[model samples]
Target: MSLPLPRDLARALAFFLAPLLLAPLALAQQSGAASPPPPAQGATKPLPVFEIPQSGVEFQTGDTWGQNGQTFRLYGIQSCIRGTTFTNPAGAKLDCGEASIAYLAALIRDTKPRCTAVAQTASPPLIYTVCAAHVGANTLDLGTVMVTQGFAFAATDANGKPVNLQYAVAEGEAQKAKRGLWIARDLPHPTAILNKALRDAERAQ
Candidate 1:
């Protein structure tokens, strides 16, 4: 006949078996196979890098269209303009044309200081350079970034020359931070607007 085990030996056996029961659970935590963290509020992620080939672009100026507002002299391919997120579907370009006055308004609002003067010309079409991609990084103020397909127009006469409308990217120099003119460089593309604005500002001094 076998003798009964001591109480201390039984307690030790139970302790050793405890981790065995929870091993899979512990492994999961250590391997970091858990759910992803949620996104923070108002985060503006950097957009992808997209460039409009200089060739596919076309230029036209003058209030031909019965539209009113700021113009974005485009240098890239003409993208179809959907309605603003407020009035129409956010990204639907069904009835919209190639120009976006709302975008220019927003750009002017945010970049008033640097853009002391924003006017249209009747000559060479202005070049609107779109970053290779959309703005990424949702960490910025949603009100500070304008998320839309990009476009630009002629800032001078039909001579195809660079007019004052030619802008540069002015990173961190904006005093108001309008969402339209604001290019979230936090994304991975070269922002010609910000770059041009910065250059213009530097030259002004």
Candidate 2:
């Protein structure tokens, strides 16, 4: 066994080592260098958001698709789930999910939006992304269009809280205006459906 460090020797070593250990931070602070803000709780660092190629792009739903063997979804929007229906003004029932998918596909065709992948999720390895498209003289975030136009919804966690709060604001405006799917009296909200599913799964467990 090694001999215990003498109290005086330990004190002397610490006194001499403290300044060396602290010098870089002190110098950085003195030079006005700033450290990057820490990532949000339970959040990963976002990947670089470069323009994704349009080749092999396929629309799987209103808010998700596959490209180059990778699945990608809009960062803050949820498409209506398949098998849901809503009423039109003629009292005829329309498939809400199909409508969302159709609208998204049309927008993609017309606008040819460019996206930047930001994060990835597991279970099938889905990428979350933000996209932009030009409409007239203005460039718009694609999620804003999807939610604000009432075709899609502000995406939420299992707790029913929006993943991106700004999308919630847009959704509110769309709701107040009663646009697109919002005009239907029987629109089945994705968040409601998802939350119910979560609760059901928990109860089953």
Q: Model 2 — TM-score against the truth?
A: 0.73
Off by over 4 Å in 2: 1-56
lDDT of 1 by residue, 1-205 (tens): 4344344233222222232333333334335857322212342332112322323222221111111222223221112222211223343322222234444343433432121111122221111222222233323211123222232221221232222222222223331252322232222122232233334445666
Model 1 worst lDDT window (10 residues):
113-122
Best by lDDT: 2
**Which tens-of-lDDT digit does each residue in 30-103 have in candidate 2?**
35767522222454546445554546677767887777777677766777876678998889998887889899
Model 1 steric clash total = 56
Q: Model 2, residue 121: what's the lDDT?
A: 42
The models' CA-based lDDT, in order, is 0.27, 0.68
Q: List RMSD in Å for every model shown.
A: 28.7, 17.6
